[model samples]
Target: MADDDDLLGELLRFKLEAAGHDVTIVEDGQSALQAARSGKHDLMVLDSMMPVLSGPQVLRALTEEGSALPVVMLTARKGQDDVLDALSAGARDYLTKPFIPDELVARVNTILKNEGNRVASADH
Candidate 1:
């Protein structure tokens, strides 16, 4: 997950780890982009606002590179425009800040499950 807020980052990290996920927390969008491009993670929980590169910018970059990495956009921008922008940019899911931890985990798990299924089918 990429979030500058230390508390929120740690909180989500704890929750995700508890649910059997190997989580990596990055403080900025640049690191988030690097992490995504490295192909070390199965999915990404990205914050829309960050220093260096914003989440939408990262999405655009990855799309240009033909990356199929699944990205879950987590941001405080509750505006419809922001949501549409991120979704249109290719985010697998858009979640606003102050989200319910359990719900976020459930959503992440669902996305990962679906992605795994898609990959499995593609390999056949």
Candidate 2:
């Protein structure tokens, strides 16, 4: 997961960890990109307005590189256009800030479960 805001990042990490997830935290989109390139991750929870590169920028780069890694964008922007931009840029899910931690965890679980099902179906 990536977010420049330390408090939010920490809170997110804590919540995810509590939900039995192993998470790696990155402070900026540049580090996020590097981690994505070098590691195997089931999903990404990205913040929209990040330093070095915005969340959508990172998603675009990943898409351009043909990475199939699923992304969930977190943002304070609640505009319809903002959501559209993120979806177009390859975010699988989007959530506005000041959200419930349980909801975030639930979303992550659902995405992972769906992705697992897709992979299993593909193998069949």
Candidate 3:
């Protein structure tokens, strides 16, 4: 996860780790991009309004590099353009800030499960 907010990051890390998911928290988009280059994660939860390159900017770079790593965008901006910008830049999912932690967990689980299914089907 890439979030500028320390409290939210800690909360998410604690919850996700508790739920049997290994979590890595980065404080900014640059670190996020660098970490993702390792192709180690199954999914990324990105905060849109981050320092040193926004979430959409990172997504755009990833897309340009042909990295189809699934990304979920989190932001305080509820505007349609904000959400659309992230999606257009290659976010697989979007969430508005002040969101429920349980909901984020559910979304992450669902996305991972669906991705697993897709990979399984593709190997047939």
What are the TM-scores, per candidate, against the unseen true structure? 0.96, 0.96, 0.96
Candidate 3: TM-score?
0.96
Model 3, C-alpha of 84: deviation from truth (Å): 1.1
lDDT of 3 at 115: 93
- Per-residue accuracy of model 3 over 23-89 as CA lDDT, tens digit each: 9999899999997888999999998889998888889989999997889998898999988888888
- lDDT (tens digit, per residue) of candidate 1 on 5-101: 9999999999999999999999888999899999999999998889899988888999889889899998999999999988888899999988998
**How should the candidates be ordered by TM-score, best one leading?**
1, 3, 2
What is the TM-score (0 to 1) of candidate 1? 0.96
Residue 26 alpha-carbon offset, candidate 3, angstroms? 0.5
How many clashing residue pairs, candidate 3? 0
lDDT of each: 0.91, 0.91, 0.91
Q: What digit string (tens of lDDT, one per residue) describes model 2 on residues 1-124?
A: 9999998889989999999999999989999998888857889999989999988889999999998888999889899999998898788999999899889899999999999999999998
Clashing pairs counted in every model = 0, 0, 0
